[model samples]
Target: MSNRVINILVPVISILLGLLVGAIVMLFSGYDPVNGYIALWNGIFGDSYAIGETIRQISPYILAGLAVAFAFRTGLFNIGVEGQLMVGWFAAVYVGAAFELPMIIHLPITLLAAALAGALWGLVPGILKATLRVHEVIVTIMMNYVALHVVNALIKTVSNGSYKTEKIQPTASLRSDFLSNLTDYSTLHYGIFVALAMVIVMWFILEKTKTGFELKSVGFNENASQYAGMNVKKNIVLSMVISGAFAGLAGAMEGLGTFGSMTSLGGFTGIGFDGIAVALLGANTPLGVIFGASLFGSLKYGANNMPNAANIPLEIVSIVVALIIFFVASGYIIRVGLQRLKKKKEAK
Candidate 1:
């Protein structure tokens, strides 16, 4: 009857509904849902290697989720996380390869450059919204293209006109041994630690700091915040800067932890866009984003496994995700349904 109870019930019901939908779709497509899920489970959680890969999948997602969540909390729609991520990725990789230093020093330096690059990318949209009164959605959407081409050009220049960057010095790479044995010596690395640290930082900034309050206040009402003597413009720019920085960190994690080099992309990474879903699913909370990111990451990790192990199309994972997102997006409907039930119970 309580809001909290409804909150918990809705997600559980949503998941069951998603599964039911997936089963129906699978049956119609001449596939078996059980077999698909089994394969998906094994690929992500079957063994040590699979588990390592799951962590790998979750690493960048954590950062990307944070990007969207922070923006949402600020009451800003930051569609440019993808662009911010690209520039950050390119900056980190370029710097990573441009220098040679001790592992401890070089790694942090490169990562910082990535965060800064992302922050700059975010600032453009923030300034537009604050000074020019441009809608962030449009500015961010346009910025994605700018970042994509800029990164592409940078990649070409850095790689001597090639589509990739020279590999970073080994010192710049995140280290992991347990995962090395699994994934056939795959790329999972210490970037997970970085992501975890960032999550903690985000939590601290949002929950315990004055700046966070200012941002949230501005998000609630820019005019009110200004009337209350809060610097609304600064908060607006700062929110985007912080949001973009988180996205940049994600790009750095992927570049250094997974790819170990840069590649010229034809377009946005899509992870930034995925972050929007994550933000919504997590209710735009730090902890919620972590769980959302983990769920999505597990699905992605399992997608490849599903086909090989269960004779099912990998599309099932996407279907489940889509259903879950749909349910979350219709939260108002859920609330109304809950209210009707409460009224009937009171009548009884």
Candidate 2:
């Protein structure tokens, strides 16, 4: 098979394998897989509400996935996306709640605050990696903890020891009443448009821009890029900043679109971490990330219905998702197997 064909088949086969394994496990556990899947399907596409919720969930996933994919394309392991997202969430919420401006001004300022906060968070690791020759993964992981504490303390101080902040002002809200009314009162909002626009921006930057070429070149070969007069260090820092900006937009969706407030967290939001899986499964491409986020979002939206409709534990859905990720991670094996089949076919 051609490389493109193999690439397509790998994910497809992985998904099939994941579902098959999930079914076998359900059967062994004495739950009906057919009914479980039916419920899952219904939850994702049964009505307008389900579809709206899925899209709402997918919006953030797309942004987060883009964050990870952009960094991966630049050969950076940005483990700190979670931290950047948290700080961004706080920044967006703080600005949204603290300000009393017109919608035109308030919303843009709030979104900018979130993006800037995330860029600052990512800048630390980028600078460390470029100047001190420190490993990005280590710095980012450490930053996650620091970010959590910093946000928590800030929230506590502002809320007078409370863990949650006040709701954002109406002007700063991203929620769209029209969307909600159209979707049967689902929580879908204008944030989905923001996320989609960002995806297009990312794709354009990576595929058509000179700066993007330099960054990809640096990732491909730092020494060659340096010899070619490209600012490798600058590109490294820029990549992280842009990646964090995407992550921040994700936090903005949550703060301004979904929750409309900031909540102190003792742990990671899980969205950034899940973005790693999303980036991998999406093959680190923008369009791929959209589809990957859609699949993951569907599963997340549908998982709750499985227990009630199929008498299956919620853990089964988790297992299924995990299996899919595992299969995606092991895609190289599938590639090798496909190459062998192609060789045999040619031999015959």
Candidate 3:
């Protein structure tokens, strides 16, 4: 079989295996997997509201996945997406609430603030990695904590000790009454359009640009890229900045679209961590990230109905998702097994 076929088959096979394992677990636990899945499906697609919410849920996941995937392609592990997202969220909300400009100017400015904040957060690690050879993973992990506490403190300061910020100005909000009414008053917004635009942006940058080639070349071999006269350190820093910008847009989606305000969080939102799985599942491609994010968004939103509709634990869905991620992570094993089987068939 061609490698292209195998590449396609891997995710399909992994999903099937995950569902099969989930079924077995459900059987052993005395629950009906069929009903559980049906409930899950209904929860995601039973009505227009469900569909709208699922799309809304997917918007942020797409940007987050792109952030992680971009870093991965650049040979960097950015574990600080969560931190970057929080700072972005705070920045966007601050601009939205504090300003009173028209929508054309206000919305763009709010979004820009978010992206800038995220890029600045990412720049620290990028600079450290480029200049001092500090590991991005460690630096990013520490930055997540810094972002969390610092944003929390800022929120308190802005709101006078309140846990939430004031409502964003209407002009800056991504929410649309038309979309909400179309989807039975679901919290749907124009953020999906923003997410889709970034998908194209990522694709165009990686597949059709010289900077992207340099970035990928650096990722493949720093020494070789340096020998070729490419600025390795510059590429590294640029990659991180772009990746951070994507993460910041994700936070903007939540603040400007879903909630229209920033809230002090007691813990991480888990969106950034989930992006790792999303990137893995999508094979770190822009188009694949959409599919991965859709699946995750559906499962996550639909899991809420399992307990009520099928008496199945919500944890079952989590297990299934985890198993899918495990299989994706172990894709090499599946590829090897398939290749061996092909060889045996050829001999026969």
Pick by lDDT: which candidate is best? Answer: 3
Query: Which residue pairs does candidate 2 place in steric collision?
Result: none
Query: Against the correct fold, how does model 2 do in TM-score?
Result: 0.94
Model 1, 179-281: lDDT tens digits are 6775566667888889889889999998899998999999999888999999888889999999999999989987888888888887677899988888887
lDDT of all predictions: 0.85, 0.90, 0.91
Task: Give the residue spans of candidate 1 off by over 4 A.
Answer: 1-8, 182-184, 314-317, 328-347
Tell me, by TM-score, which candidate is best. Answer: 3
Model 2 stretches astray by more than 4 angstroms: 1-9, 328-332, 339-343
Per-residue alpha-carbon lDDT of candidate 2 for residues 67-140, written as tens digits (9 for 90 to 100): 99999999898888888889889999999999899999999999999999999999989998989889999999
Write model 3 residue lDDT over 94-114, tens digit each, in one string: 999999999999999999999
- Clashing residue pairs in all predictions, respectively, total 0, 0, 0
Arranged by TM-score, best first: 3, 2, 1
The alpha-carbon deviation from the true structure for residue 230 of candidate 3, after best TM-score superposition, in angstroms, is: 1.5
lDDT of 3 at 33: 88
Q: What does the lDDT read for residue 100 in candidate 2? A: 100
TM-score-wise, the better of 1 and 2 is: 2
